[model samples]
Target: MRRSLAALAALLVAFSALTVGRADAADAVITDFGVQAGESDRVQTVALQRAIDETSAGGGGRLTVPEGEFRTGALDLKAGVELHLAEGAVLLGSDDIADFPIRQTRIEGKVQPWVPAVLNAKGLSGVRVTGPGTLDGDGKPYWTAFWKRRAENRKCTNLEVHRPRLMYFESCDDVEVIDLNLRNSGFWNLHVYKCAGVRIEGVSIRAPHGDPPRITGDDQPWDEVSIDRAPSSDGIDVDSCQSVVIRDCVISVGDDCIALKGTKGPRAMEDEASPPVENILIEGCDFQSGHGVMTCGSEATIVRNVVVRDCKVGPGVPVCRLKLRPDTPQRYENLLFDGLTLDGAQSLFDVKPWRQFYDPQGMAPPKSEVRNVVLRNITGSLRSLGDLRGNRGDSIENVTLSNIELITDRGDLRVGEVVGLRYVGVVINGDEIEAPDSE
Candidate 1:
């Protein structure tokens, strides 16, 4: 184990050296471009873009935003550029949809038309966003729009509603996002798509707690809506990415704190020839008030070799989740969750079929598979042991639970369609189920 940790550390060091070595020598401050804080009608978008473009044109360097609230629209990032926000700096997103131009991007594993994010970096290398500052998405308008749309159509999907994300990085290499407070996103907070050698550290993401904002169209005030009205406010979503490391982050949002996904179905299968998401490492994180601490797949083609360790999940946060949609072809394997302390979660491990948006688009339904999952050294207070249900002839296989202690009201371990299930030193309320019943 020691040797394995050493090797991992060495690999991280090598990756950092390779990526950080490409940054330029000097820093370019945005304030030098006549950006001010006190003006009511001022939008820092143009000024910030000027700084980034000039820096990139002059051989990429750091574009620094000093301490102030700078309202901005979509700011496209360039290669070899680092966006640094100083302490007390707040990069506020404009609520107007016009500020975000429509672009072709990947959402839910398919390429489609979508509003560009507040900060977008595509096809870039050695890009970084680091600072103790904040990126506030100001998502109230978009959230209201989504609720109204849902009211009209009860079965509307996420893509049907138009909203912009906080930060979106696509097809980028050697990306690093560190020490930033990302809050109140209109959609997913941080989305890293089809990126490699990514490292996200010391980030804090939070959405509005309590109730969703109320719609004021029918004699109602917007701020009084129930918190449940907030939709798709995910914390960090890593989609079709490789060699990713996320550590020391505190996340609490309306949706999953950390979600991993791949291609949706036949379209993704035709585009890619290999696994979509692989070699992901998540450690030393705190999760609170989310759908799940870590969830895999509503649309995944192949996700393999993921490790989650040393995480603390607050009350009502599921430790881990695996979601398989019948319409999407998926293969999830070699996932490990170790040293997790969970509290008041609905379940410790949740594996079930997802049927929220079940449109296969006339394609033949494909068989999904989940195999080789390990849960070790987990201590938690959960509502139940959890459920593992899979389709017939496509069973979940080789799941091992070791050194687990849980205090729960109900210890019923629902093992449905699982093969080679093993439990070692597992105790639930001072009683061991011994052999879990499998169907």
Candidate 2:
């Protein structure tokens, strides 16, 4: 028996060595390529790309960005490489649109021709971006351009405005982004598309808080504007990804804090059988300001086994939201929200059919299904209890709520086209609502 145990230990050590051997070949430094700060010609982009390429070519290793402001365009990350940004370092994005070249990428759940992100990684494995510094997207120019276009066309969709994301990882596996401050993005801050085993922890994603500053080229001054000028600047968007764990992050942006979406458009849906986004866990996150702390789809095909717990959401944001667009075929099920503490949020739960940019293209609107949701141990002060109104041919099913204590002046629970709802020990405004009829 002792000899057998020794043999098992030897096998375990060999497996661990093999795993580590596949990743780190050697440690490479970025300073070897003359990547220094305060260059007169701003040739940091070329230097950085050369560093990444050389490191990848010489067998992957760690590419360390030392303490300085490195302004660059789109830098593609490679497999078995770790981009480590040290303290006092800042990776600044170039303001020129020419920096980010156009590529065939996924945007808003549909694969289309769009500009790549400032930092992009695709089809790689064992990639990591760890930092104690910041990634600042110089988004003022993009914001000014978008507002100008909006002034010309008041009814413009998000697609109409051509903006680049801050960081995007596509079809990458075993990714880790930790302890970084990603701020002031042109569009969506961090987007993970068609990836697996992604873990984002201890990160802060922020856009401009209030009204945008007045630029010299813009005619209008966006002073005291109530609406967000940074349109569609979502904090983190997980699109058609699986096995994602986002925890210990502070997200405050103009759009949803975290959203999940699947393949969109009829053509994409018919041609490709994209996998559903499942097994997502978001916990221990602090949401300062956003649309919703956790939102699921205006373009999802199937989203299942999602849990958002142990999160604190600040004022003026919804705790949880599920958007069902009638034009997109979707199914959202097995979602759980627990141990959430809200401070004067707009609503506790919001599940409704979203009609923004709904184009059926001469076809009948598709129906959606939302089922098997459970919300428990929620203590909050909200304005409303929220709505659960499905579309005409669709309905919500098997929703359960328990141990919810909320203080709201109007406990308006609008339940329409719902089936098999169970409420237990729910207290709102000093009244216990044991059943659905008690409301």
Candidate 3:
């Protein structure tokens, strides 16, 4: 029989070199389904998440976390799983907060509940978490109870400090998280919700060196006070859901590196609940220590086709921010911030809306709107600057600032509108005003 078909093609090339070869799915090996290397096993991450929930309930595989040191706690990834963290693996995170527990997740989206994730993959479909190991969220007791409630209530609620997140994939589909490092987390450090064909490549998220915590009720008294302590730390929080593609990632944060959300309102457009975030694509990324390198909505609801191209922003954050929350039926349409490199900032763009200590008791306060925003080719330089307020009653209309070359030290450019508008390329303190062309 042709030597039994050449010994079945040499046993499929020795079972493809004992797993872990080229890709295209088909790698189902998990160190014999229990993974181990150098001790500290919480039964080896619960026997490798029960062998990836019994091989994705008999229809999937590939959940290997080889290499070493895996002091586990919360690692739940199912649905045709594919979490391979070989090459010196680490997966540590057990600073014990009940070793993590608090289900029904979905942050920034309107599920209003979280907790559970030191790497979680939910309601999946072809989910993946490639190699180049390390998913450590050993956040020193939730960064010491978020600085003891920011030294005693200066306004707190990151779920009242019970942090735990270093990878949270929700309502997923065809997801792929490549080359990882994802470190020090106790909250918000790669949280994607209601996903679809999402791909986050070459990741490297870090955290350490805490010294920021002030958050004191907003509504402009210097708007955002403190709250930058890499504690409830967020560095990639895409909510609602969409066809996402965040390329070559690298974020240094204590808050907001990329936050575009949706789904929060009178049940947020009810379509049987959920679904609002739209086609998002954040190109080649780079940001350092949070506060808007790319942020939108305060708790978004209808964000549109967002495309932030070739990026890089550093030093004293805030290159472009629009946190509208006049209660919460937000809408930031067709946003496109092209080829950017604002190497320093304090504000290049900021739209307002946050009705003082906002309260949408039963929803119906948010009438927030910011239309066709496009900040093309931007370069930067700014210090001790802030405020580009627009909301004399739901403002920020059809903004288009092209070839932005900023250099501000409060060098004025504070234009406020609301009376049949038309404002363009404004420059204050160096005057170049040309607004008032509307009838």
Per-residue lDDT of candidate 1, residues 56-119 (tens digit): 8888878888887888889999866789999998898998888888889878776788888999
Off by over 4 Å in 3: 1-43, 46-68, 71-89, 92-102, 112-115, 119-263, 267-294, 298-318, 323-341, 344-347, 350-366, 369-393, 396-439
- Once superposed on the true structure, which residue ranges of model 2 sit more than 4 Å away at CA? 1-25, 40-43, 211-228, 266-273, 435-439
Minimal lDDT window, size 10, model 1: 15-24
TM-score of each: 0.92, 0.89, 0.32
Error of 1 at 255 (Å): 0.5
TM-score for candidate 3: 0.32
Residue 111 of model 2: what lDDT?
A: 78
Better of 1 and 3 by TM-score: 1
Task: Choose 2 or 3, whichever is better by lDDT.
Answer: 2
Go through the candidates in order and give each one's C-alpha lDDT. 0.81, 0.80, 0.68
Candidate achieving higher lDDT, 1 or 3? 1
Best by TM-score: 1
The global Cα lDDT (0 to 1) of model 1 is 0.81
Superior by lDDT: candidate 1 or candidate 2: 1
Off by over 4 Å in 1: 1-24, 213-229, 266-268, 273-275
- Clash-forming residue pairs, model 2: none
